[model samples]
Target: MLKISEDKRDTIIAKLKQDIDAANAYYEETIEPAVMERYAIFHADKDYYRKMFPRLSKRCEITSTDVQDTIESTMPVLMKTFFGSTDVVTIQGADGTDEDSDRAEKMQELINYELQQNKFFMKFYRWAKDALITNLGIIKVDWDREYKEVQKTITMDAEAYAQYRPQAEAMGIKVNAAETNPAGGINVTYTAQELAKNRPRVMNLMASEFRFSLDATRLEDADFVAHRKIVSIDYLRMQGESGMYQNVEEVAQKAVAPHYTTLDTQNNEYIDEQPNRTDTGRQKVELYECYVNLNMSDDPDGRLTPMIVTVSNGVILRCEENTYERNPFFVLSPRVEPHHIWPETGFTDLIAQVQHSKTAIIRQMIYNIAQGNDSKMAIDTAALVDINDVLNNAQFIRVKGNVSEALQPLPAAQLQSWTFNMLEYLDTVKENRTGITKYNQGLDSNSLNKTATGISIITQQSNQRLELIARIFAETGLTELFRFLIKLNQLFINEELVIRLTNGPMKIDPSDLDGSFDLIVNAGMGAGAKQTNLQNLQMVRELSTQLAEVGLSGPQQWYNLAKRIIEEVGFKNVDDFLIDPSQMAAQMPQQGEQETAGEDSKTTIRSAITDAPWQVQMQFWQKLGFDVTPQMFTEQVAQKVLSSAADAQAKADASRGDVMHDRLQQANLARPRGGGRMAGTTSNAGAQAGGSTGALEPASQYNGTMAGNAAGSTTAGVSSY
Candidate 1:
């Protein structure tokens, strides 16, 4: 139990309230309005934005859902474009550790594995994409072990030990002070001189160690935020201010600190709002879990002070300096603000004007329907008992003569036409503001102004806007989350673990890894187009094959290029679709050919040796009747055999390249062709030089025939795939 003085208690509570008051002030004024607006839009609650409706008309569902529809329709599209297409997270070592690049890549794989196993990554993306207007994202670490079980000890020296009396035969470290040595250690003592002389010799110590264990865990946001939080530009700063402790090292390894659960019990500040529960306007705070980090401290290093304190409300429940092992939680402050530069507002802010216009149109349409036409009406004000009843119902009232013509059911054509025009105008405003439109959303555009060039420009703009938001989430939320993962792994990983990273298998010890990694997120194409990547890959592949025939690149280079294309296409494991070079080498027929060539060369050499007089010849003399010596015969046979093998392999590769290039070209041919689109231009440079000589064309567009393609052949025939 902590011994807290009353005065200190009052001070801490007062300071907490002061901070809360400041946060609340910001929340009530700046954050609340935008947050509330976003909330209403999400819930489709017409009443929330009903105040902004036209004064002459009541709020209508059709007008209120305008903003909601725009937001909802755009959310899935943005998510599909970003997360749907981009399925890779690449972590590369930027601090010049390419020697261990594979290790870092494996760590990335491990993270992805760990992420999918526990983290709400996709779920969070789905939730955060639309809501990105207010906050970029809320990333939390769901680790295998948020905290470890640790034993702590309390040790007292000889003087304190001798003076201590045993209250219990055996005991824990926690007991009342009145009980002498309540930790229950037997007192041991000796004369000062005798102790000094023999203490080392006897290996006897008077010091007593009282040990106890505690459960440590990471903190949730509720552990710290007792009052409402303001998630503005200052929110992270406010969180930084909340950290307070005694002497525990700020980045301490094993120092004793209070676990969030312990602090929560002491403070009793938790109010659980079930996250999965369906409700509107629920207050949810994230990134405010300071106590989780406070739970971690350096390993009781003598340099830093240890703390054991708990509180309830503003009052201190307990504050002690008892020795204990602390939890190991580390969180990084986000490097980028998630609010995406619009700190004062969000997605709803951009839609507010359009929403008002939509509401006015809806209200006018309502009036048009109520009045039965778009013409002037002159009904005597006193002719009806109730004007509202006359408009809404078929209630008849004593009117000045016949009131039927006065209530003209004017032309429906004008009413319907104008309402639709207003709707179209409002939709255009929404499309411009949000960068979401019928074209992008897969809805056909009815506007006469849409052209291929114009639609193309709008498509690019929409993609860029979504790309910006996705990147904001990536840079701030995902990056910070990765930092936290690296920190935690560094602190807690004890041994190497083998993980089959998406590319290949690798072994990694997270603790051994440095945290200087550059995160490369393949956010994929913001436009739902995969052709550009495929086309570029095909071109590169062709270039690589051509380079190999010219001896510029080795076989390994082409193999690597192929692997890259497979991965770029979003294949998790490339070996499935692509052949492994090692496997191909193992299956190759080069071994048998070398063996056969060696035997033939040996036969020729033996024949040359035996051809000379029934004796082992020291040297072969190539003169008179024998044109070749034994060595010459061997060289000739070896060169001929190896050349055959090399020539065969080259021909096989050339044929394969020709087939693949043709297939790719055909895929292009299958698509609707247009100018400025990447086109395959034929170059006979390689073909004419090395065309169809049963060897790879080193410079031809068609990688066939080192002797040049057959004269007058057009493009390589496309396979009817």
Candidate 2:
């Protein structure tokens, strides 16, 4: 807590007030009219009717909420694109784009783990987006200690005091300095209880917190102050950054709401319970605290440029002048007016003008018709009790003479055809200016029925207007958010953060993370991405298939592209929504084995089996120890039984012939040693007719089929010799 003199505090308040007053003046003069009109559009009641058509206000109180509804309709689209349900922010480390590096990988995991624990995107992205669209979007990077000493009330007797006081003091517990107690020992707060075995080991953990601020309530635009270089600004009359921050806090204290927290769930029946510090009507609110950032400082690089002041209950709770090594706040706009500090245009701004015109014309027409419908009458005053009661009731005139009254009709008023034409023109203007229409807004009517494709094409073409705004926001706001997260990592995280990744778990070592990476915004990505992505993936899918067919891509590469395609189609990551290619490793034949076994031979054998009946294929495969089923075998499976049997019998005969020939050769060699003369070669005729066992079976055996079916049958002439 920094001290400020009474005189100085008043001076600081005066200075802050002066700036606020001046800013408010600018707001009221230039921007307030449009904002008030927007409010009228939102309310769409008497004020609106008066604003649009003063004369017709009493007659027709119809005010359309089209603009407000259209604006709201854009929100979900923006959210889906901005913080896509899949991957929104990518972690780029100081070590360049190589995500495989140790530090880079760890940093990515740390960010992921933090996001999972905090749900910053899930909870706050949409709120911030709303702020961006109408007002100013902001983000703050916070780093606070996760661990705290337990605060428990403990009573001590003299004996317990003697034992506990020494131990408590050793553990850094502060004791109350009361003089003496009427009781033997004093009751005091002991904060040294080390949560231990009584608590399960898993329970011993610290949960980090995430919070987002969508405060644009009292905010006067920052770009106005910054770009205008609003000079002659008075400071809080402090010496340094810290002192100035303290003064800013004083200002915020006066502005923040008293008993700010509502504590809606503190007493809810469905909500789970937690230890809470509660007051009577409004509880002690740690979560509902508010913040103000004065980002008008001249020095862009110096500390306290965007000074932070936090307050609750009309008192300054925290004030600090620091940086996230970069600006902590991010500003976004859906559309910006040219040469304007703050964009005064929105999706429905122009629609109001048209709506007002249409309302005035319709109301005037109704008024004219009503006046004409009330036919003028020349009734004698004596005939009626009162002139005011002339048309009050259907009266029977007492005059017997035929009333020479003719039902004269006023000249029929015809609305010009161009009135509708002008209304159509106005409608066209609204569609042109805002890119919003009944068709795009999903308003159902017989007159306007556009196909979704036609509507989508028109919508996409119209998005060109918003795309530039989004690009500008991405460049400034998104980059700042990345910087904020990096600084938090550097300041708060000390333990290794485990983040599950596609390859494996990456341990994000905060100390090793060097936050230096470019923030790249893909124009083809985000809100409009879903449509373009589908088209692109369709094309890429074809190209990928062609590449695979041409042997230019491997299975792994194909798999990676497939995962991306899955995501491009707005599905979750491949790991969650798509089947993993690696999961089929067990089912696939190993590379070496497949090659060594000769695929050509296997293909021939498989073809033969495939051409056979399902039953026969199953029986043949069963003999070969293959688990084949009738359902599993396709028509491609052929003559399995006949092929396997013939091949087996042929193999058996070849083996027997080789064995007999070898034995006969050995006998011939032995006979020669016993002094038998070597007969040159047996006459071809002798072996042809009745030959020795070792002699060839002429050419007949070699030419014809040697073996019969493998059911132990052989051709009669077929000889093993």
Candidate 3:
């Protein structure tokens, strides 16, 4: 820690104050006015008009609600696109090692758990809405330890109290009461402010309270970033007492009044404009938590150090070097300009002019219709018998002069049909600007072209713009937020964080999460894209099934396919539908073993049935729900067994023949030699008496040549006579 003297602190504070002034000046002059304009339009519900209407006419004022319509209708879609699943973001392992993969997974789980605990959904909702409306949204992420007060009432006897007294004192328990009962039991009522929790926090900061350097194009490149807020004097005192701040008592004594900016006034519908005269401790002071690089003149090393400075009423409440490696603020924008950090125009901003044009056209149309429905009459007061009756619109009007000449109906202008055409044209313009149409909002009843192809085209085109916005948000702020979270866990977390996941309870140790990882945000593209993805996944499943039939795929592959399909269908917990291959692997047999076991079991049952007595076999078949006699069953089984045995014998004989042929070829004894003659021969007379064969004769010549060959003898071709 770099210590600063009083003079050096004053000099640094002055320089920061100058920077703050310049930043605020630019914000008020440029960004704030535009924000105020959009804010009014988005929340516009009252009647508004640029000029007064004529007397005794319909002065009905109308304000177009297209701004609100565009924002509210688009918000739900963006929310669903980002938060449709539990894995809002996923982690990819660095270096592709198994340990890194495991670490990445555990880190992701821990980050997601922290997000859920901090109510990240609401924070994201607010942040996205701000960006859509104001062209910029910011969130602050930090690590902090917070203490929440807890109250408990314990009933203990005298002996138990003696045992618990020291523990209660250590816990800083404030006793409210101690009552003794007749049953020799005492009830102890005390409040223990000891629920100290340490975790990462995500806070959605209002645009009005955030400021940054004006000359920078991005937050990372900015020289200073500050969150201007109002805190009570007592809050500062408490922080000081906790040793988190210094010189806070002096600042609290001179606490300044809260200064509400123009944007703040617009955001707050009903704000009190009074200063606190009494209760100085409860008075609110303007506090600017500025993160900047300060180079003090104290002269150890003149280089700049990243510092977190807390300023209120020209006094430094706290100043220290920033321990978190990076800045804590993350900004999100749907659209960006080439040369500036602030977005060019938000969704509402682009359609603001269209809203104004439609409001004007609709207002005129209403006015013209009113005049046409109730036209004014030209009456002569001098010839009128009762002017009061004519003025009161009485059914009967008495005129002394010629009725036709005395009372004449004035022609009021009828509304032009082109005005309605102009209104419709403006609606089209609004749709084109914001990519929000009736089709996207589920109001496609009036569409002229209702063909499936046309509808799909429209849906895809509309969703492309939304998908782009989602991609921007996911890639920019969301990724940075999770990265910051990982860094926080690495820096502050020491013990294991036990989180109950969808599969089961998992313990993530800090040491297990030490690595570099890549983040992937799981943002749904759109309905059209999702449908396409689902089709693709289904096709993959078909291919996988085919491969499995041919023994190319296994249980693990099937499990992965099934898990992916479930996730694509918007279900996060695949365990509810399918068992994991890893867990099932422990209890299941190999594929070949399973098949062999199945066949053996069947054969065993059949043999047991065959060997049983007649009565037992009959009873067994009866118990199996087969209505058959023992003889019939036995005959069927005998035939099956015979067929099986014959097939096995034929296969064995064929295999042996192949092996013998190969051996004969290798030995060059397949063909007859020496003129194809046998070694032993005799004359015709000797041959007639008996059979004097040179070699083994054929089976048809009354010799057992085939049986000898079947017995693996080599006397088939040259047999003994």
Candidate 4:
């Protein structure tokens, strides 16, 4: 750390303070008003309605949920699209060497593992939701090192203690107590100082807590950016002890000086509805972690270098040059407008006007209906005995004078059909604006009456809108987040990392990830598009099989197709379904042996097919694109059938059924009774008829016997039929 003179330090702090105050002022004056309005729309705040339509206390004040509905529905789609698989992020090696590929795989695993450890799903949910509601969502990623201590008590001999003390003390462990035991060994109690491992930290900052230069379009181009947080005084002291800060006593003293809570600013006051903290005897202070480019006038080049400074209550806590060489914040917006830091429109923004119009219309409609149902009467008070009698729903009311003259009912205005028609029109307008509709949401009543082709087209167009948002997020913020994490891991996490994935454990060394790697985002398209892709892949799979017979496609092509299909279907363990082509090729016999074995294999295969059940044989031939029967099983057809089956079997293994009986018993216990009968179960009528039901024919496949009880419920157990 460079030791700075008091005057120079003051000059730097003043410059940062000036920049932060100006940025905050600009945000409070301009951006926050719109953000607050959007939040009110999202929550459907009654005050927001009151502000819109003033002094309508007794009238209908119902607010529409258009904003909430749009945001909520879109969030699940975006989340599932990004995180549908284990490999949310992938890296491709630049050189394409085996070593580089392996390193890239390990690096990708390490990045994903770090994200999992940080509970990134929930963080992303919040971040994306914020971006949808407000125009921008921000996240900070940095390498954090904090102390972790554990206390341990152990019994050991004096010689063992002597051997351990030096090593333990070198690691900063403190010996609390040591005493001789009755059995001639020492019982020692000590607080062990664990290794200070550097790990990546991800924090989702509210739009209010972050500030940047007003003219900057991106974080990297900004001259100043700061994150404001209210931290405890003790946290500052800890930083001093960790040698991360200078002038601890002065900084703590300055922080203790009374100041407004960091979140109490006008920009952040309505950011969230949270209770004020009661006195907890721990002093709290506002801390600004600012990243800025400071020009040291003494330098001859006069270039501005990126630096990080921590300040609180006009006191500098820590200052150092930025070693990471880039900004740590990643921003997300559903749509990016040209020449703007935040998008001009958000999901809620698009629907805000619709919600307002709908709410007003609904309130008017209900008010009109209410008035019509309880009509006001023009009663002659002088002729009526009591006014309260008219208000009550009484069968007959006594009037002092003629009944017809004293109590004439006032005619209420009848609501026109256009009132309801207008509401529907507004809903249609909303659907058009947001690309969310009752049809796509599966809520339209008339959707079933429409042709399947029409419905599919509508769904496809709607999905295209959502897919654009997903792609924008994937190509921008998500990519930046992974890139930032990769750089952090390379810089701070020098040692090997051992992470356990779903498949198995992997050991990754960050140093091995030295070469360039391109990021591969695994964002999924919408469900309809995915289904289309799956269909295409299936068609390709069939084509690959056919080509395999002619030597155009082989086991490698088949394995690749199977791998893609399995991944698209959301399966991670490809090995469970398909054998690797390399392994299968290695297992093949030599040319001489294969020639002899081919004849023997064909004879055995034909015998097996002949003995198989007629249903199985028919289905097998049909799957091969052949409509065949027992009469069609000639020698010429058998040769073609055997050749196709051999190729298919070589590429992939058919999965065997693995069921646990204990789990089945548990499921049976949980299953409710007195419902539909299980498959292969005989009914009471069949039991009384005294013959096997056709349902029992399939029991031969599982080698199970079904016996009917007195209650006519069949019990299935494993036995030869």
Candidate 5:
């Protein structure tokens, strides 16, 4: 433990108290007065001071009295009060503390420093206010309420007090001696922490109106700047090159020939032109050329200049120079009218003219035929010539008169062969026509009829025997005849020859070559038969086995065959064919011996009818008879046998007192009634007969008796089993 003597402790405590008191007094007397001065200045300027003093004195409620109290409340107010305002200040203390004397001396020093600081702040505030008023038009003394609040926040501390003590003493103010205290003396530190925690209101009061002065000026002289002028080459060269030309003769020689002139040079020369008219035709032309030059710059070699040249007739022509002595230049040749090398004529017009001329009379003949006219005679005459020459240059066949000789008329024989060959090709066209129409138009009964009729007509026409006017006219004879019909159809029926011929319907049956008939007969019934009848006819011919055979042959054989068959077959009435008892009896065998034979045959038949019911066989048998009902004869007999046998067994079992057997037999005979139970009464007699009360014996006993009866029947009689 550390201890101090009572005297030393007392001295230390007294020194600390004195120092605190001095610090407080300094702030009250010095720092507070200086801040008040600034506050007064800030309050005077309203507009210019608002940014710094955001709040006015009225809003902040700051006053000189409030400021003084604030300073007195804070111990460090002394340091901020005096030294805070001046550039520098010093505080003086007594060497030794003799209680009253030391305290009085220190207090005097602090008071002196405080007074000096007050004077310093007053001077600073006055100077600042004057500066702002002079330069920025601001009256610092009239600042608003916020400025007054700022004035209240000024504070000071021990170091500041000590620093200003010497000046304070010189100003007749007291300072305090430095000392330490056993209990911590009044704190004189102004740390940001203490300011933030304990003096926020005061600090905010000052901050709200805090301001500083700024000075600015613009430089008069700047380094980067310029001014100048540009000269023109045209202006410099306006005096002409003569003054600058040393070798005039050489330049003149060079100018004697044409030289190329660029657009810019030409424009310049054009701009420098003068107008004049007192000149020869050549001179006048030169003036015109000069006029052109005045509107354009001269070419480098004067290539665009038009010169006047006189001809023998005194005609003047403008020509561009072609010399290249000075510099190469482009010269355009004189314009001339173009002459036609050949005339134009249309092929159609030429052909028309040829058709009208007598020398080409054949052309007209061909044109008439091509237009679907009846030109058979002319075609016949042309067809007699060489085929290549006739066809290639054929008068009756050429569509256009201008057709070349290579397509002349074909010879009659060759033409006949070609026509025949074309018929073969027409077959393909016929096939294609059917296929195309079938695909596009769809197959229907009507279309099929039309097709068959068309095919028949075409086939007949193709195979027809024609009477030729002459052998040499065969080509024209056939073609002209066919063409006439085609043209007639085209004119009257409005159908094309190619379509009428090639698009003819498909042949229904190629084998029936002689079945040609008019399609319009019987309202087109013949057309329907063109397909169906031909098909039937074909079947009769090709499939003879399938037909009724007849030995007749050649033309009309079918008709004869039909007649003979009809005559041989006598007519019979329906009743004559009907089954009678006599016929039925004849169909059956005689009784007795016949019956034996029938029985033998029945055995074989029965074997064949195995697994078939008697009723089924009897139905078939009665079908052979005219008046028998299988139901009355067969089904009734079967029902009677079944009923009688069932009844007899029932009576026998009852009489035997075999109640179990009786019940069993009843069960066997009884059909199912309802609810899945057999329709038979339980025999109470069985219980009475000393049998098991609730049960019946098996059917084996009855089965044995029936078997025994069946064996006895076989031995007793020979009847149909």
Candidate 6:
């Protein structure tokens, strides 16, 4: 049984209760409103049915009057007698008590039964009557005797009555009374299904029936007014003597300048002084190179003012008075200066060249070729070619011309010198490039170093070598030179066949072509023996046939030989022979087994106690003494030895157990034991000896004895309880 601490148990209980409470609270607060809303919608539907049923019954009654005049006259009487005569009729039977009251329960029951039977038709009838009276200006049946006598005295017109009957019905009223006043009363009857069909139309009419009046005048009389007193104050104050007005006047005075001047009469001072003619109103107007000075103050009343003028194209006019004073004020035309010249020139050419070089380099990078002959130009071209070669293949390079044509105009000697100098320059600049003090700061030194230097050198060398080779080719026009070398290589490799197809007719021997075909097919089949060589052979044969049709005889001959090999030798022998070349070389003799001579030499040692009977059983304690007796080894000593041996064996066995057992035990705590069989002994002598031993002592006995010893030792240990 397991016992838990009170604190832990209490904590678990508290947490469980907290979760339960939270669940309960969530259900109550969030779920209740949705349930209430659904209930409200259901009740609203029931209310609509209860309130609309009477209006539906009134509309139906008016529709029934179309077929019979008596129906039109009797409808009112029937409503008064069967339903009720009240404005808002409480439908009832003939009982004098209120039809809904319990005292008139039978009458209420009768009314309800009648309502179920004819309520829809009755409502439609009522709606038709009201519609006819309102829209067609047709009269409903007069309940008063005066209207009934007049209707009875008028001669009934059948055609007029028939034509207007439907219109009258559509308008929810009856016009059939004057035409159908037969001695027997007009008859009208309908089933529930028929009434239901018409019920919607009746209900729609009732729904649309409305009363309107001129209420706008009444609304106006209730709230309209002719005059209203505004309580707004003036934002701008008049400039009177008051302080508020004075403040406004001061503000206005500051806002606008005075246009007139006044004189001070008390001191006889000219309040508005006439300004000096030359100083106050002097105007020097410069019209191009001319200056016109007008003194407006000379005419005190501002009439025509005298003006002084001077004109000069490029000279200054100085008016020197009789006083002999130098006047600085003189009109002088500014001299035009020649256009300024830029200090430096030819930068544009240098810029354009640099741009052209950069553009060329970029274009070469994309096209995978070197172009141009200048030093920087050649360097850029080489760099670009190197970059492109690193990114793509040499075959993609655009320059197809031989090396000599490619290098024709280059200054080879000068470029070689410059390349060596550039190498030296790179070596010298490397330290500066990487950084003189591990902090790179020199731009010019860094510019000379690049990771692509090796590629650049290789590209330059390749171009030069190609150019040299092209020069040789161009000068000698030796078209067969490369082909001759290839042919020699092929001959040395023992591949002599040359299959060619020409526009002219040529005959090919099938056997010769099949042999070449076999060579190629066998080469591939040799490496992949597991593949179906026959399928590959068949495919090659078909492709070769197709190629032959297209005049590609070389490939056809190769494939044909492959097909012959596949058909003749079969895939097994052909694949084996191709794959293992030694199989085709020579057959070696099978080796026979050689007898191993046993060693006759042996080592012998003298017995320590020859005369004493040998005790092989007691060999474990042989080092103790030869005189030791079996009985001298007591159970305790035996048990102790067994325990020690068992303990040591257990420790050793733990290390020696099956690795799988250790893994299973490590992975699972409940691993079952004794589930695997021990390995069988391989030695015949050991097997026979083990059989003769009558199954060795059970391991349980040794374990029990060891456990007993362990128990005894445990008993002697210091006890805490």
TM-score of 1: 0.52
> Which sections of candidate 4 miss by over 4 Å?
55-58, 86-89, 146-192, 256-281, 391-396, 400-402, 522-524, 550-552, 572-576, 579-721
Which lDDT values do the candidates have, in the order given?
0.46, 0.48, 0.74, 0.73, 0.29, 0.27
lDDT of 5 by residue, 620-657 (tens): 54454422234323433443355466678778777778
For candidate 1, write residues 1-721 as lDDT tens digits.
4434566556545654554445445445554455555656555455654665545435244555666676667667555554442443467787756556755766666666655555444555544643443432222332343323233334565456545534322332332233235566433431111111100000110001000111112222212222112122233233234443231222122222222222123224553324332422232322121121122233444253344333323333335452313322212111233422224456666777677677677777787675664455456566555666556656455565567743544354346777788788878887877777777776774644677656666566666665666565555545555655655565556666665555566777655465567777775555444545677789988888788788998766777777767755666466676776766787667887886687567556545543454223323332222222244233333433443554565566567788765665555334431222111112223222222111111223333531242353322211000
Say which candidate scores most in lDDT: 3
lDDT of 4 at 271: 32
Question: Which candidate has the top score in TM-score?
Answer: 3
> Would you list the rank order by lDDT, best first?
3, 4, 2, 1, 5, 6
Over 4 Å off in model 3, which ranges? Answer: 1-3, 45-58, 86-88, 147-195, 269-272, 296-301, 446-449, 522-524, 549-552, 586-721
Cα RMSD (Å) per model?
Answer: 20.0, 15.5, 12.7, 17.9, 60.6, 54.5
The candidate 5 region of ten consecutive residues with least summed lDDT is 286-295
User: What's the lDDT of the predicted structure labeled candidate 1?
Assistant: 0.46
Instruction: List model 4 lDDT by residue over 240-287, tens digit each.
Output: 888887776776566553344333454456433432345322566778
Per-residue CA lDDT of model 6 for 452-539, tens digit only, reads 4443343333233223322222222111211222222222222222222222223322222111100000122121121244555668
Q: Provide the TM-score for each candidate, comma-separated.
A: 0.52, 0.57, 0.75, 0.73, 0.11, 0.10
lDDT winner between candidates 2 and 3: 3
List candidate 1 stretches off by more than 4 Å.
1-17, 54-61, 81-89, 95-98, 142-312, 315-342, 373-419, 445-458, 498-507, 510-515, 521-525, 554-556, 567-570, 580-721
